[model samples]
Target: MLVFVTGGVRSGKSDFAERRAISLLKENGSNLHYIATNQVYDKEMQERVKRHQQTREKSGANWIVWEQPRKIDELFSHFKKDDVLLLDCVTTLVSNELFSGWETNSEKWKNVVFQFEIEQNLKCLFSQLAGAPWHVVIVSNEVSYDGFASDEGTKVYKRLLGRLHQHIVLLAKEAIMVECGLPCWKKGGIRT
Candidate 1:
């Protein structure tokens, strides 16, 4: 099953997805693999990464963590049909691609090449999940209502992210938008 969990910053989306994944694994006696997509590039990010790592460590030892800030498709070689893989986000990966200039000159979109790169990467990832046997949970920020970004770069980033959300939500078996610890289903039925 492919589950996409999304919310504004600090809206408990990750917690909710992690709990759901744990329940699924416990019921099926399967392994949990956390594919972390964030990198500690600065003090703030470092602290945030540390805090998240601590939380994961306390959560339990049944999980095997893989820190893949980019190139997530590479991990498919190691995953099994019975495993549960939770990818902590599409946002970070997109940001990385943008800053790294992967979208500067692509034919898919008139915008930056990284824009197409990010979208293509996400589409490929979700497409793989559509055919994979393992359960996949994806966590991402709900940037829709964050207000218009002030600069050109910000505006472009928002456009790409919004498009990415739409693309993934279409492929998601279950799509949720969370707020204040509550989840509102955007599409698909909840798993029984």
Candidate 2:
């Protein structure tokens, strides 16, 4: 099964995802796995990362964590038959790809990424996710709730995330939107 959970910043999305993983593990005896895609480039990020780690620890869940800021497709190789792969924050992963020059769009002024090479990459990634033998949970942030972006780069980034989330929901069995510590199920049931 593929589950997609998304919400605003600090809206209890990650905590909800983590708790769901633990519940799923208890229900099915699946080995829990967590993939963190954010890289700590500053003190604030480092503190956030530390807090996440501490939260996971305090929950007492045995999460086998893997940090992969890019090359997200390669993550499927580590999956197992009875494992539950929880990819926390797809937004960060996409940002890394875009800033590191992996996305491809026709915006001339947008020079960070070129669109000539990402089709096959996205295809392979989706294929891998679909073909995985175990269940998967993906956590992402909702970027379209606020007002219009003031800059071209922010606009492009928001559009990219919106498009990516749409594609992922199509492939997922469940889709949920979290707000203020509550979840609104956009697709599928709560017990899925």
Candidate 3:
């Protein structure tokens, strides 16, 4: 099963998803796994990472935590059918890939090519979720709610994120938009 939870930054989306996944895991045993995507690139990010770690630790020490900034396909291979795989957020994954220069910057291209490629990458990722061995809970940021960003990079980031979320929504067994600590399920009949 794939549950895609999306909301604005600091909208309690991650907390909501984590609690949902953990609740399910409690019934099935302590086989919950958190796949963190945030890369601690600066002091603020490091602190944020520590806080998230503390949250998970307080929840349960039985939960398996894996921090992978890139190569999600490789990461999923470690999961089992009984485990719950919770992805903290996909927005950070995009930023990580972008800053890592996986998307080339050509003076000639209008950034459209890179955007399309990223969308394709996301498509491939969701496609891989079909008949997955584990219960997957994906968390993402909903950036489209905010008005258009001014800078070129911000615009491109927003565009790619929207596209990525759209692609995942199509393949997701359960698609939800979190707001004010509440979830609106757009697909499937998951009662959350």
* Top candidate when judged by lDDT against the true structure: 1
Q: Give candidate 2 misplaced runs (Cα > 4 Å).
A: 101-113
What does candidate 1's lDDT look like per residue over 87-133, in tens digits?
88888877766656444653333356657766777788778876788
For candidate 3, lDDT tens digit of each residue in 1-192? 778999887878888888878866775634788888887769998988888888888876467888888778887777777678788789988777655653475332145776677668767876786457667789999887888798877777787778788878887788888888888888885566
Rank candidates, lDDT, best first. Answer: 1, 2, 3
lDDT of each: 0.80, 0.79, 0.77
Give stretches of model 3 more than 4 Å off.
27-30, 102-111, 190-192
Q: Please, what are the lDDT tens digits per residue for candidate 2 over residues 1-192?
A: 778899999999998888877877887746899889998889999999999999999998888999998787677667778688888888887777666633454354275445224433554565577567777788999888787999986877787778778888898888888889998889986742
- Number of residue pairs clashing in candidate 1, backbone atoms closer than 3 angstroms, sequence gap of 3 or more or interchain: 6
Better by TM-score, candidate 3 or 2 = 2
The Cα RMSD in angstroms, rounded to one decimal, for candidate 3 relative to the true structure is 2.9
